[model samples]
Target: MNRYFRLCIFFFFAVITALPSQTSASWQPEITIGLSQGLSGVHLSSTSGVLYVYEDLESKPILELPQGSELNVRILRDQIMANGQEIKGDQLIIQPGADGFIRVNHAPYRGYITLLKRKGLTVVNHVLVEDYLCGVVPKEMPPSWSAEALRAQSVAARTFALKNRKRHASEGFDLCSTSHCQVYEGMSAEMWTTTEAVNRTHGEVLFYKGEVIDALFHTDSGGMTESSENVWGSSVPYLCAVIESQMQTQPWERSVSLDALMQKMEKSGKPLGTLKEIRLSPLSIGKGSGDRSLSGRVRSVLFIGTTGSVVLSGNDLRSIFSLPSTLFDIRFRGGEVIFSGYGSGHGLGLSQWGAKELAEKGKNYKDILLHYYSGVTLEKLY
Candidate 1:
């Protein structure tokens, strides 16, 4: 062998050895999803679609256990397993399933479950809350929640699940908890609408380092959510708006003549309307962009569904806002952002309306996640 060639081979191996080993296709099969759903069944979000079922434990009903049974079992933290599915972990992250709530471990965080006695069975129902709306699922979840926030959550869940289906895997879901991504919990079938949103936005995709990542999701925390990447520092999406449409259309909106407004330009020849109003709009107003106010002779247009206010500057007839790459049905008006943005979550990654669409579509929880988020995969952690 040539001495030079041997040296090159050694150098090549050294570089290869220094690189991180890529993860191969995972072969872990699912064991079981654990949650405390009774005959009423539980719900789990999946790429195939929304699934519902129930399962109960053969062990003592936490509530009805004969006095002595209570002694055998203890309420450690506020959690209990359901459907007789044995779980060995600090906690189980359950998806409401067709047989019952499916159990999987993401991470033991916060929230509580209900335990009571009815007849001979010990009733256990885990009220899992994978903080979909607020910031990282806090241990003490706020009692009062915004219906709109929940809707964003449904969209996130569906988008996440749907992308996994495209990956063509059979058993496992992407971890839906922790800061690495958003959190999820299947406490009831009522959230089926949430899953429907997932299926509707199917086949959507995204890439990291050009490799497909299971899109993690979350509900609206104001107009902010997690971002895929930043300065390589944060692990969440920053506050931004997902534009849905263009062409501002409204009989009333059209009634106000832009040409006429331009005709009213100042004698100095400067455009009269310079984003004339500093008014406010609904946080996520799909109602014609937002509220329009009169600032002197100028028109101040307020936008809905954003974290904070941004001023987009242009020569004329333009609206600017920051977004990832794709432009989904968002309407932008031309001007400079005068206000600051607040909170982080998907303004449009999962629209509140989108969540309602999920529910109306008859999609289960899993189905909802698969719809909105694109390009990614799902895995289950036991």
Candidate 2:
């Protein structure tokens, strides 16, 4: 009986080993990020594990420092220098500590980091794609939200990161930790719920025609979402208008003087001498008419000024006024521009609030993604 049981166990192990593993080394690629720029120096420290610094692309590390060692890096005469030693290479790679975190200029980050002297400063914080996403998920969405919602968010964020990987190529980094790219807070913003969400949907991304789509998202969609052509001047097949019943009504009211409005426009490079009259053409919540998008979001508005009347898109007006969204009504009354609007953000792709509501109502992450991004397939890239 014992011999038969051993034979069965051996066969089971052999079969398992023959099958392919999803998370192979080649699938998980390391992602480079420029954490901080325009810095002539950086101070790093690791307490738990030995920090290895590589000055070249060689297999062996040049400096294997002890734990809790504080190292300072600087640039001198257009050459990289570390700890007062003239390093040969233009970059230095610092491996993460045994605790899986490294301190860069007092802030902790997961995975390895590379320091490079570029232009007038040092570029810091290069990390793996998964480690970077762990910091991004919690900062982008509430960690306490439904698991399904967070999981959807994880996939969307991952897709966005991969799609825009070369956004900052000229700046010597793939992406920045700001709204321009994706808000990454590093180890300081790590949350267990968000981390689990990222792990649950690891390497999963939304793809259209075998290419990763720009998985844009926003806070709310008011009543309807807009197509990509109307909002961003590109007609994307998957980013079509759709009504979101789960989203609540969000109204925003603001008042600004005509002088202030003119000043704002001037700062935006559109110098209108003086404001005369503001006309707003109204459209239905789900229908576009005249200068509005298919979802009734403003596409363009005519601004009557003393010098000359200039036409601007609703998105442009939103930026000048710091409004939440382009869906708004404007009226010039008593020398003040009274504006009232609904929803928030660009109203382009997935609605984060809509996802939360759907998750609460028993919808899974996959369902939420399909509802927002139509005609797209969820693929496991790594």
Best by TM-score: 2
Which 10 residues in a row give candidate 1 its minimum summed lDDT? 23-32
165: Cα error in model 1, Å: 15
Question: Which portions of model 2 show Cα errors greater than 4 Å?
Answer: 1-24, 97-100, 246-248, 266-273
Tens digit of per-residue lDDT, candidate 2, span 1-382:
2434533553454334221211113335455567888788888877467777776545577777788787888888887778888887677888755654678887888766778777745555666678889999998899999999999999999989878876887776778888888899788899999999999998788888766789998888877888998877888998888888743358788899988888888887778798887666875688788888777788888888888788889888887778998888888789899878788989988888888888999999999999999899887765
44-155, model 1: which lDDT tens digit per residue?
A: 2322222222122323222221211111222233333344543233222222222222222222212222222222112222321222222222211222333333433533
C-alpha RMSD between model 1 and the true structure: 17.4
Span of ten consecutive residues with least summed lDDT in model 2: 17-26
